[model samples]
Target: MAGMDEAVAELAAEHGDLDALLAGLADDRWLLPTPAEGWDIRDQVSHLADTNDICVDTITGGPRPLNEEALKFPTPEAFTQSGVDKGRAMTPAAVLDWWRTSAARNRDVLLQKDARDRVPWGLGMSAKMMATARMMETWAHAGDVRGALGMEPSATPRLRGIAFLTLRAVPYALSYAKVEQPAGTLRADLTYNGETWPIGPDDADNVITGDALEFCRLGIRRASRAQTSTLKAQGALAEAALDNLRAFL
Candidate 1:
């Protein structure tokens, strides 16, 4: 498991990477459509900025919890749209400034908490876990911005955290999808930079073997089983997990 400091550092690195990407783009390019339907580069950054505030609010016990605020909107889509709408109203520079400000505050707040402390994230998770989730989200959104710019996304060592989160959150993913649990245990054996990162028991009969980047994509619902050429899942639970698992709420 990653310590709180290490996780927060990774989160900071992810943020820095995204910030560099956004910094180079021309203002007009902010309107380019990303792979995510109906979302442009600006919308993506806006959503991140809004979520950063919600994260801080959730941890500080501000006026409302993230889940509670979501309830005020008619549907989850509406709640998400609300954030995008906020971004649309700002200039690209303003949106970037907002993201940087909130991200800094979020990191500062996270650093003040203990690693074992459970925060009010989706399903509630340890501070380390929340940091990892934030890193994963930043990386995933960065991929969106890259795709919009016609850039090919690559894997980094940081993907180790995301892959671990994917495997660790398998049960939550299955439960959220209301899929019946399989009898066999599922294992993930992913490779990145010639390194094999394994998660699960040594004797597990079910296994998912693939590029760590693709596995992260699968876990984030960015790639379906059919979309990945390198990933293979053996046994029932592994197959179901490959198709239905989601690492984000």
Candidate 2:
């Protein structure tokens, strides 16, 4: 129910924060390895920029088709391979600049569109969904950067929307991981903005509770289960949920 302007502003602000973080890093820092396999700081930035380009193409109804190519890869392994190949040759500064420009263009398009209008991105999502996806991407990649640099990222209240959306998609993410939870019952309690959003059954033995940002980080697999104090998953359901979890399909 959030408006386009609000969504765009939140996403754009996160983009600016990410840009600042990338810009402040030294060349050597950019070369440091991240949690993402075979990718460093530069690759993470490039991937974010590449994502923006794809979003822009989708939103504008451009000539490019929103197929596997635009979406990049069907699997995380394939996506990482493509990013490694593309990012190996790029300079850090170039990657940073490209992301800045691409994100700005996407922001402009979002600002111009109706919030409810449908945009043909991968998996058929509305303009608001596209914006939310962008926000999720920013948060996920920011985790990659944070992991590499050993820095802690502050939680953004606005990201609660994306986090809630992600919870709804939990079953889908689990399916992608090729893992299934027991039928009985389970609940995930996520806290943000001084409120708790529960996902799953009311009378469930499994419960995953955490700060919203940490929950997002764990869901994306950017932060290892051992690294987060905000997360507490009880029973086998919690463990099953963590295996091969990913934000993007």
Candidate 3:
């Protein structure tokens, strides 16, 4: 809750960067494929728009039924594809409008809530946690958009929220993998903006130190544990955590 102010600001900045990235596109460009296989620009935005509605609903006390049919799919990727296929009927303009409006309202509603209030997120999380999750999603998918446009991602202090959340979620990640917590407390000695940002228990032997973007990439599953040489670890839990971490649920 303490970083709520900075987290909200960074979320806004992320959306702004996305807007700048998608400023102009020929109609054909909107139809082009992105890094998410089987998804084009419209599908990517459509997914974001759909989730925006869910975010709003969570805060507004109007929960909708999860798509049971989609849940029947064997994998999360398949579940997503089912929705993206149905969303194909939306013209790009309509999808873009929905996303823009929902994102705006999302900011407004969250700004009015107390940090401790529960938001019906993945499994009931704090308002600040929800906002941080939104930032993670926004930044992760924004990469797909950039890939489609052949542009490099630019970093900002906004990543601070994502990095913090990634480190904090380590315990949950261990549970998700059903792995026993390694024998000691954990620590993250990450560096962002040329300054080291140390977090977690000080006496812990587990340490993960690296570039913020690369660590963020690991959480988003965009990069593998073996591929991120920039990420260094010094304990059992740290090694396993790096391999199994997730920024997105």
Best by lDDT: 1
> What's the TM-score of each model vs. the native?
0.96, 0.79, 0.90
lDDT of 2 by residue, 1-249 (tens): 347888888898888778778876788999898888877888888878876776787777665435545355676667546644566678877777888998999899888888888887655667887788788888788878988989776577765766765665667777876777455455778888898877677888877788777778776666777877877768776666655446665
The order by descending TM-score is 1, 3, 2
**What C-alpha lDDT values do all the predictions have?**
0.89, 0.75, 0.78
Ranked by lDDT, the better of candidates 1 and 2 is 1
lDDT of 3 by residue, 3-54 (tens): 4675577778888887776666666787889988878888887787777776
List, residue by residue over 85-160, the lDDT tens digit for candidate 1: 9999999999999999999988988898889998977679998888899899888999999999998775789999
Instruction: List the lowest-lDDT window of 10 residues for candidate 1.
Output: 1-10
Collision pairs in model 3:
219-247
Cα error of candidate 3 at position 92, Å: 1.5
Which pairs of residues have clashing backbones in candidate 1? none
- C-alpha RMSD (angstroms) for model 2: 3.6
Model 2 TM-score, all chains together:
0.79
